[model samples]
Target: MDGLGFTVDQMAEAERRGRLFGLAGDVLQWSGPPIHTVQSAADELGLSAEEVARVWALLGLTVTGPDVAALSQADVDALATWVALKAVVGQDGAYGLLRVVGTAMARLAEAESTMIRAGMPDIQMTHTHDELATAQAYRAIAEFVPGSGT
Candidate 1:
């Protein structure tokens, strides 16, 4: 099967094994430049396959398309930043981060593809992960903000 198909298969396997909740990215060993295998991405980020899969599976959408052959370096970096933010934020942190980053990442991917479709504009979704990480941190703090003793 092609790379996108293979990625779906891997995701299914992860879900079946119940490791989907703890996916760590290195489960696939992807070597291609743009298409990152789960295992390879995990290794690159010093994360476990289980952790990567877990985080990945939490997304409401499935990643597909030629542009999604491998996790772009930019996306991979963003995911790593999200994970690091998760460290200090924990479960609630993850919830907020996922909600925000997941949507932003999706938009960023769309924009990237648009650029590619529009003759490869020099603009790219860079450092979005950092922006996502910051958003998560802010959300965590917001949760604690005093609210009229509601």
Candidate 2:
């Protein structure tokens, strides 16, 4: 049987990686936690679909169909963070963050995707989420402080 672009060795490596990541078989067939559709997430966050889309779009995300399952837990957290940011920085500052941060992250993801498609090594799972978050917090602070990391 023809295997298209995937050789037996490549398929084996994929299986090994999937097993290591606790993922079963295909991404489509994987039994995993529930992610949210745009509409459902809006309902959960008590926001209008238009509002959610506006914010999510600022982050370079476009959800065309309401039933499209696209959002993860981090996206949910982002919505909550938006609420907190509004309380702290008011409306304009919060939206500004959505535009700046979203664009930056989307660009970063594009770069990462390009490297990965060019066969960069698999992503390392060295830092726990907590450790990564703490490191990111420090890095953001250092970037903000003039001549700190320079």
Q: Which candidate's lDDT is highest?
A: 2
Per-prediction TM-score = 0.39, 0.52
**Model 1 alpha-carbon miss at residue 65, Å:** 13
* Model 1 deviation from native, Cα RMSD in Å: 17.3
Question: What is candidate 1's local distance difference test score?
Answer: 0.53
Best by TM-score: 2
lDDT of 2 by residue, 35-95 (tens): 8887888898887877888888987777757787767766777697797778899889889
Please give the lDDT score at residue 12 for candidate 1.
Answer: 72
Which residue runs does candidate 1 get wrong by more than 4 Å?
1-33, 63-69, 103-150
lDDT of 1 by residue, 70-149 (tens): 56676578778877877778868786767776687567657644644355222122323343343333333334323311
